[model samples]
Target: MTNDSSRASGNQVSWQKRLQDNFDKYIRLVLTLANNSSQASGNEITWQKRLQYKFDNFMSKGGMSVFLALVSVFITAFAVMTTARYVVERFFPNGPTKGTDDLLWEIFVQLIGLRDTGDEANFAAKFVGVITIFMGLVLFSSLVAFITQQFESRLELLRKGKSLVVEENHTLILGFGDRVVDIIKELVLANESESDAVVVILADKDKEEMDDFLRNNIAELKTTRVVTRNGPIANLSNLDKVGVKVAKSIIILNDSKSSDNEQFKTLSDARVVKGILAVVAANGEENLPPIIVELHSEQYRRLAQNIAPGAVTTLNEADILARILVQTSRSVGLARVYLNLVGFEGNEFYFYRSKSGWNNITFGQLPFHLLQAVPLGIRHGDGTLTLKTNKDYKLSKDDEAIVLAGDDSTIEFFPEPVVQHNRIGCVERNQTLELETENYLIIGWNSKTAIALEEYAKSVVKDSQVNLAVEVLTDEIKAEFENIAKAYPHIKMEVMQVNMDSLDQLKTLKPYKFNSISILAGSGENAEEIDAKTLTILLELRQFFKEYSAATKTKVTTNLIAEIIDSQNTDLVIKAGVKDFLLTNQFVSKILAQVSQEPDVMSIYEDLFSLDGSELYIKPIWLYFPANQIGKLTFADCILAAQNRDEVCIGVRISSQAQIKNKNFGIYLAPTLDKDFILTVYDALITLADDQN
Candidate 1:
C-alpha cells in the first residue's frame, strides 16, 4: 500500500506539470495572435480612415480641407515607405540601392497586387496618394472659380441714374427777355390744337425769373411742360443743354434791356448771331428748321439776314411801337382791326382766283355777289390802296379777290344787284371849336422827351396853352428853356428851380394837376433813386390830378423810359398806376439791339410814322357792304384801300378762341387761306391825305 501511494502521487504531479505547461503555451499563442491581428487592423484603418477624415474636412472647410487631406495622404504613404524600406535594408543592406523610377514602378506594381514585399506596397501607397492629391486639386480649383464669380456679381449693380437725354419735337427759344412772354403766348395759341408741344427756354437769366414769369402770366403753359435751362447762347456746350440739335424751330430774341448805346447793342447782337451760326453749323442745316431773329436797327437787318439767310429779321422796336401809336391814336378800334388783318384767328387776308364769282363783278357789284363778306378793296397788279376805284374796274383772270369773311360767311351770291347807298353828310363844328389846353407840366428830360414834345405839339389843337416845368440842375438847361419860353408867347412856360427829391418841393409845383401832365426822367440821380422818386411823384400826381379834374377828361402820361438801370424797377413803376409809362431805356435798348440786326427797317419805320398813304393808319373797313373782306385778302388789297382813303393794314389781333381752328394762325402774320378775316372797329388809321374832293 505504501508503494502504490507513492506512484499515484508521482503520476499526479507529472500530469499537473504537463497541464500547466500546455496552458502556458496556449495563453502565449492566444496573446500573440490577438496582438498581431490588432496591429494589422490598426495599420489598415490608419491609412484609409485617416484619408477619409481628411477628405470630409476638406469638403467642410474650403481651403484648409485640401491641405489636411494632402497631409493625411502623405503620412500614410510615409508610414508604408518606412516599413518597406526597413524590410528591404534589413534583408539586403549590401545590395544595390534602387533608382527613384524603379522604386516608384515597384510601389505601383505592389499597390496593384502584382508585386511582392513591403517596398512595393509602400510605392503603391504613394500612387494612391497621387490620385487623391489630383482630386483635391480639382476641388480647390472649382471652389476658387465659384468664389471669384460670386464676388464679381456683387460689383455690377452700382452704376445706372445720371444721364440726360432729350425727347423729339421740342420748341427751342435761345434767349429770354420781355419778348419771350409775347412769343410764348403766340406759341401757346399755335399749339392748342396739337397733341403735345414742348417749349424749352435757354437763358442766361436765373431760372427763378423765367419760371415765375411763366407761372404768373402763362398758367396754361404749366400743363405743357416748359423747361427753363441756364445757358449762354454764345457757347455750344450751353446750346447743347437746350437741345438745339433736336429743336423744331428756334426764334432768337434780341435782348430787350441791354445797354442803350448802339455799339453795345451791336456787339451783343453780333455775339448772339455768331453763336446761333455755330449751333446751326454743328447741328447741320438739314436737321435744323427755320431761325427768326429780331433786329432793332433797320440798317443792321442785312447783317442779320446774312447770318441766317432765309430767316425773317424784323426791327422789333420801331416797327411795332410806331405802328401802335400811329394807328391807335386816331382810329378807335384800329389796333384791334389791324390784329385781325395779320392774325391767324377771326379774319385774315387771303387771295383766291377772281373768276370764281368776282371775275366780272365791279367794286359795287362785289358787295352783292359776296353777300356774306364785304369787298373792302382789291389788289391790282401794282400794289395801291384805291378806295374810290370804279366799281366797273375791269376784272381780269390774273386779278386776285380780296374780301373779308367771318366763320359763317356764305359763298352764295345775292339774288339781285342792289344800288350803292348814299353816304351821310358830316356835321361841321360852328367855328372850329378851339381845343383848350391848360398848363402842361414836363418833368425831367431825355431824348424821347424832345420827340414826345414834338408829337404833343402836332397832336395839340391850335388854341391849347402849354407850360414847361423843369428841375433845373444846370445853367445850360435853364437858359435853353428860358429862350424857348420867349419864342412861344401865346403859352406860359414856368421853370421851377426846386429839389425834385424833396416831396415838399414837389408838392409846391401845383401844376402837376394840369389837363395833360407828363413826368419824365429824374435828373442828376442814380437809377434806383430816380425810379423811386419818379414813381412817388407820378403816384402823387395821379391822386392829386384825379381829385382836381373831378369831371374832366384828364389824361396823364408818365415816362418810365430812361430810369431802367435795372429792370426790376418795372414792377414798382407799373404798380404806381401810370397809364403811359414809356420805358425809354427798355425801348431804346430793344431798338438798338434790333436795328443792329436790320438797318433798312429805318425807312419802313419812317413810313410807319408819317401821315400819308405810307403812314401807320387804322382805316375802318366797311364790312357791312358785304364785299369788304379782310379774311384771306392779299396785301395788295390792303394797299388799294389805303390808296383811295390814305390808310394801311399792318397787323391784326384776333380772338383767342378762333386761333385753334386755324392751327398755323398767329397774331403777327396773316394766314394764307383763312376765310374768316373780317375788319373790326379797330382795323386801320387815317393820315392826312390830299383832299381829292
Candidate 2:
C-alpha cells in the first residue's frame, strides 16, 4: 500500500511541472508579439511623419513646386504605361504587338484623351486596356485640375503685388496719404525732361485701389511712370522686393488719417522710424540712398537725423505752414511767389556750379550775366547756403549760385555780361518803415492754428491783437490757447465760441477793423466738409465787406489769407477773391518732392521760412524804385534797385491782375532782363529780404 501511495505523489508532481513549463512558454510568446507589434507601429508613424515633412518642404517653393509636380505626373504616367504594356504583351501572346516607341506613343495619346482603345486579340488584353484608359482619365483629369489651380494661385499673388520689382534707379515712395498725389504730380512735372523716369510706390494699401486713385488724380503723368506695390513698408522683405538697394531716392509720407489724432500720429511716426530703419537694414548704412521722411513730431525728426546723419532729410508740415502763414499774412501777394518758387510747374530753385565763369562776380551783378535765371543766394563749397547775401559779396570759385529758373536747361552761364544797358534804370532806395502793432482776425481752427499763432507772436509787435473764432471750443482747445497766450505774453489773445455758419454772428466780430483775416480749415473726418465750412465763412465775410463798404462808404482793405487743405479746391478759393490761399497738402508735398531731388534745397527753404534769416516779401513798387521811375523800369532795373537795399527782387505783382486766377495774381518770377514792367505805387515787388520792411 505505501509503495502505491508514493507512486501517486510522483505522478501529481510531474503533472504540476508540465503545467508550469507550458505557462512559461505562453508568457514568453505574448511578450515577444507585443514588442514586435510596438516597434512596427512606431516605424509606420515615423515614415508618415517624414513623408508629410518632405511634402510641406516641397510645396513651400512656389513655382518650382508646380514644375516638379508636373514632372512627377509625367514620370508616373510613363511607369504605368510601361507596366501595362508589358502585362498585355506578355500575358496575351495572341494579341498583335507594336514597337516600344509606338506603344509608348499610344499610351501617351490615350492619357491625354486624344484616342480610344485600340484592337486586342484576347479577353485578358482587352480588360487590361480598359483599365489603362480608366486610369489615364483619372490621372490626366487630376493633373489638369492641379495645373489650373496653380495658375490661379500665381495670378492671385500678382494681384496682391507680391512680385518683386526688377528695376534700378527708381524713385521709391514708401507710404500713401493725401500728399502722395501731390508728390507724384510734382515728380511727373520734374521728370518731363527725362525720357524714362520711374516712381515706384509701396504702401500698406490695396494694390488695385492705389492704382485707381493715382490714375484718377494725376490727369497727366508726362514722362514719369508710376508703379505701385502693396505691402507693409516696415518689413525688410518688402523693402527688398521694392528694390530699395538700387533706388535713387526714397520718400516716406506720414499717415494722413492720423494727422489729427495724437495717439495715431505717435504710432505713425513710430512706423516711419521703423521704415527708415528697415531701409538702412536692406541697403546697409553705407549703401543707403537719399531718404526724405515727413514727421509731425520734432522728436522723431531728430531721431531720424541721428539714425542716418546727412543721408536723411526730414520735413515738418506744421512748422513750414506756420512760417508761411506768418510771412504771407504780412504780405499781400507773396503766396503766389512761394507757390511758384517751390513748385516744378513754374520757376524752381536750382544750384549751378561753374568751373570757371562764375568766379569773382558780386552777388548783385550775377543776375546780369544770366539770361533768364535770377540769383537768390550763394551755396558755399562746405554746404552752407546764404540767401540774399549783401550786394558786395563776391562769388568764389568754390561757390554755387542758387538761382531761380524756368528749367534747368534754361540756366546758362555767360562768360561776358549780357546786361541790357538801356533797360537798366537809376532809382533811389525807399526809406524803411517802422514795425507797427496790428489787429488780426482768425476764423476757424485746426492743427496748424496754434503753430500759426506762435509764428505770429514771433513776428507781431507788442500789444498786437489776435481774435480766434470757432464753431465749438472744447476744454482741450481752450487749454492750448491759454498755454500759447501764456508763452507769448506780448501778443494779446481773445478766444470766442461763435457759430461760424451764422452770418449774424460773423458780422458782430467787426472783421473789417482787423488788418488781416485768416480763414483756417475746420477739423472734421471729411476733408471736403472741412474745406466747405471754410468756403462758407469766406463767402459770408466777402459779402459782408461789400455791403459794409457800400453802406458806410468806408474803404475796407483787409487782406484775406485762407488755408486750403485740398489742392483741388484752390481754384474755387481763388475764384472767391481769395488772392492769398495756402494749399497746405500741396505745399508740403512740393517741398518734400523738391528736397528729394536736391537735398540742399531743404536748408534753403528752412532759411527762407524761418524768421531769423532772410524771407520772401512783397513790398510796394515804391520801396524799390521812385514813383517817377516805377513805370519806366525793367525787371532787371528792379533787381538792381533791390540789390541796393540788400534784398533780392524775384518778381513783380501788378494790381490790375490781382483778381485774375489764371494770371497767377499778376506775379511774374524770373522774367527776362529785357522784359519791361509798367509798375505803379499800388503794385508790389516780390523780394527776398531780412524783414518785411
Best by lDDT: 2
Q: Report the poorest 10 consecutive residues by lDDT, candidate 2.
A: 421-430
Position 634, candidate 1: lDDT: 37
Off by over 4 Å in 2: 5-9, 12-16, 19-23, 26-30, 33-56, 59-63, 86-101, 118-129, 256-259, 357-359, 422-424, 430-437, 461-464, 473-493
Global local distance difference test of model 2: 0.84
User: Tens digit of lDDT per residue, candidate 1, span 256-358?
Assistant: 3322445756765676667667667758756655565656555566766665565434444434543343233333333333334332235433343443444
Instruction: Specify the poorest-scoring 10-residue window by lDDT in model 1.
Output: 156-165
Deviation in Å, model 1, residue 234 alpha carbon = 3.5
Clashing pairs in 2: none
